[model samples]
Target chain A: GDKVKQSPSALSLQEGTNSALRCNFSIAATTVQWFLQNPRGSLMNLFYLVPGTKENGRLKSAFDSKESYSTLHIRDAQLEDSGTYFCAAEAPGGSAKLIFGEGTKLTVSS
Target chain B: EAAVTQSPRNKVTVTGGNVTLSCRQTNSHNYMYWYRQDTGHGLRLIHYSYGAGNLQIGDVPDGYKATRTTQEDFFLLLELASPSQTSLYFCASSDRDTQYFGPGTRLLVL
Candidate 1:
C-alpha cells in the first residue's frame, strides 16, 4: 500500500488555463510540500504547507491534515510550467522524512 | 530563498564500484535529507539528519549510507553500486517547517 497517492498521473493543459494536482496520504501527515521538477531535472520547492492554504503568484496550495490530503492549483498555466509536480507529506512520528507520491506530469501547450 | 547545491551533477559507475554524492546548504538549517527518485516511485527518503554527527534511518535506507559532518554539509555514499541504484538523487534542507531541494545528481550504474 502506498503511503501517499497522487491523482491524474499525467495532465495536459492549454496556456492560460487552470488545473489542480492532488495527493492523498494514508499516514498521519503533519505537513506537506509541493515540488516541480523541470525538464532539466531540477526539483524546486513551490509550496510548504501546514494544514492551511497559501498563494504565491498564480500558484495556490492547500494541506488538510485532518482530511489527509493536499492540493496544488496552478492558474493561468504557462509554457514554462510543463514539468512533473510531486507532493510529499511529513508524518507525525518521522524524523523529518517525507513520503512522496508518484508525481503528476504536466504539459502545458501553447 | 534557500541555497542547496549538489556536486558531480552526473555520475557513472560499474557494479561493486564506490561513489559519493555531496550536498551543501547555506541556509543554516537544522535538518538535512537525501532522497532517490525513480520513474514510478517519485521520491523516497534514504536518510536524514537533524544536525552534524546525527543520522536517522529513512523508509528506504538499505544500500545507502549518509553522513552529516557539519551544519552545512551532508553526504551520501554508495559502497557497492548496482544497476537498481541508478536514479536521480536529491538533497534537501529544512528549518523544521519548509524544505528546499538542491539540484539533483543523476547516477547510472552499469
Candidate 2:
C-alpha cells in the first residue's frame, strides 16, 4: 500500500478552466508540499501548506492534517500549465523527509 | 528563493559502470534529498541528509549511495550501475518546511 496516494491520476483541462487534484495519506502527515514538473524536466514548487489553505495567483492548496488529505486547485488554467503535478507529505517525528504520491498528469489544452 | 543545481543534466553509461551525480544548493538549507522518477513509479526517495556527514536511507536505496559533504553540496553515487537504474534523478534542498528541487539529471544505462 502507498503511504501517499494521489487521485485523478490523469486530468485534462481547457484553457481558462479549473480543476482540482487530491492526495490521501495513510501516514499521519504534518505538512504538505505541491510541485509541478514541467516538460523540460524541472520541478517547480507551487505551495507549501501546514494544515491550512494557501492561495497564490490562480492556484490554491489546502492541507488537512486531521483528515490526512490534501488538495490543489488550479483556476484559469493555461497550456503552459500542462505537466505532472506531485504532492509530497511530511510525517510526524521526521527530519523533513517527504513521501511523494504517484502524481497527477495534467494536460491543459487550448 | 532557493537555488538548487545538478551537474551533467544528461548521462549515458554502460552496465556495471561507475557514475556520480552532483547537486548543490545556494541557499543555506539544512536538509537535502535524492530521488528517482520512473514511468510507473512517480518518484521514490533514494537518500537524504540533515547536515554534513549525516546520511539517511530512503525508501529505494538498494542501488544508491549519497553523501552530504558540506552544507551546500550533496552527491549521489552509483558504484555499479544497472539497466534497471536508468531513470531521472532529482536533488532537493529544504529548510524543514518548503523544499526546492533541482533541474534533474537523466541517466541511461545501457
DockQ of each: 0.85, 0.84
- Once superposed on the true structure, which residue ranges of model 1 sit more than 4 Å away at CA? none
Candidate 2 DockQ category? high
Which docking category, incorrect, acceptable, medium or high, applies to candidate 1? high
TM-score for model 2? Answer: 0.97
- Each candidate structure's TM-score, on Cα atoms with residue i matched to residue i, is 0.96, 0.97
lDDT of each: 0.93, 0.93
Candidate 2 residue lDDT tens string, B7-102: 889999999999999999999999999999998788888999999999999889998898999999999999999999999999999988889999
Tens digits of lDDT, candidate 1, A1-110: 48999989999999999999999999999989998999998888898889899999999999999899999999999999999999988888856778899999999999
